[model samples]
Target: MIEARQLTKRYGDKTAVDGVDFTVRPGAVTGFLGPNGAGKSTTMRMIIGLDAPTAGTVTVNGRRYAEHSAPLHEVGALLEARSIHPGRSAFDHLMVLAHTHGIGRARVTEVIEMTGLQAVARKRAGAFSLGMGQRLGIAAALLGDPQTIMLDEPVNGLDPEGVLWIRTLLTGLAAEGRTVFVSSHLMSEMALVADHLIVVGRGRVLADTTVQELVLQAGGDTVDVTTDDPAGLRRVLTGPGVEISGRPGSEQLSVTGLPARAIGLAAARHGIALFELTARTVSLEEAFMELTKDSVEYHAANTLVGAA
Candidate 1:
């Protein structure tokens, strides 16, 4: 398990990570999600002792990373794949990391096979493609056979096959009761792999909940109704506590605070013909965008409007 308690970091006058608290339990893949410049990399660096926190603390299991007897065996991380020496062979790189902790060649070979890098284990890392480099980095992280694993953007340059391989590998590790924490800005990817999510924005916790719970918190139970007589439907839905939107002449009306069955019954009673009445739940992508819209660092203007 990994825990952060009121953890914060600041550089000069700028605060990179604010006071945040969260726990990543074992036996599941916990996704760390945030936009660029949201301080995800900073927080991960602090957890691994790469950077000092200005306030609070983070722990792997029960001790700080620096306090571990064998830190590499307790926690393994792939913060950036390009951090490896380019001239070294994939096998040689793992061998060097293993040698640091007195680990042997057998373990290195095991990880090479485990990460499917055996085919290019002897190739120079500098010549490897981005996907191959990622595989090599993962191989190094697994060399110690650590109980906790953290990966940052593991699928950034992966093809479909490599992406699936990573998904399976992480899920398998978590199923074995190890703590798996992976960070990514891709909501669709995380939604497929993560059992729980820690959503951050602007260095603060936006949500710490199960994926289902987070979606529910984003008003998941609303239903979208599309009918020819949308205005009439709006009139029928006008009542206290029933929120209705989508203007008259619009093809759809968004209805909330009422069950789908109730909406159908009301439409039936009013002799209204419904083209569509679907219970709509906010997808993980939509929820993420809504939460981080304010924190996104860059935006592109709608060019079509300008052209017109």
Candidate 2:
């Protein structure tokens, strides 16, 4: 597990991270989310001891990351920047990291195969494509078989197959009771993999909760109801705090502020024939946008010019 208490960082007169605190537990994937310039990178750097925190403390397991005798075995990290040497081959890169902790060549070979880099193990790191480079980085992360794994944007340049591969890999690691902390801007992917989330904005933690809770907090789950008498059902369902909308002449009604059970019962009382009713849950992306709407550093104009 990874824990940070009042963790902070500053540069000259600017504060990059501000008294942020969160815990990443084992046996589940925890997603790190934030808008641009929200101090996510700074926080991650502090956790791995790449940058010293100006105040407070962070620990991997029960001690600071640097305090472990075999740091790589305690925690494996793949930060945003590529840390490989351009002159080294894929196999050589993993070998170098493995050598630091006295890891054998067999483990190095295992990771190469695990990441599907066996086809290009001997290729120069500089000549590899972005996806291939990412694979190499992951191979290095798994070299030590650390108890905790942290990755930033692991799917940046991956294809659909590679994306699915990484998703399965992360879940499998968590199932083994390893701490998996992943930071990514891909909300759709995070929604699929992460069980918990730590959302940050403006150098502070905006939310630390589960994916389901956050979505419910943004706005209650929406329900889709289809009835033969749309107009009659709309009138019967309309009430205080309840919202109902549907397309003109359409049999479907989009509803909020009430659950499927309540809607169905209400329709039954009114003798309205229901054709379909589905409880549509709010997505992680929607919740993130609502929670971080005010914290976003940049905004794009809605209208675009010179469109084809």
User: How high is the CA lDDT of each candidate model?
Assistant: 0.90, 0.93
Question: How does model 1 score by TM-score?
Answer: 0.90
* Tens-digit lDDT string for candidate 2 (195-224): 999999999999999998899887769999
Candidate 2: C-alpha lDDT: 0.93
lDDT of 1 at 221: 74
RMSD of each: 2.7, 3.6
| TM-score per candidate | 0.90, 0.88
Candidate 2, residue 110: lDDT: 94
Model 1 worst lDDT run, 10 consecutive residues = 299-308
Q: CA shift at 50, candidate 2, in angstroms?
A: 1.0
Per-residue lDDT over 213-242 for candidate 1, one digit per residue giving the tens place of the 0 to 100 score: 887767767899988888888888889878
The residue pairs that clash in candidate 1, if any, are none
lDDT of 1: 0.90
lDDT of 1 at 306: 50
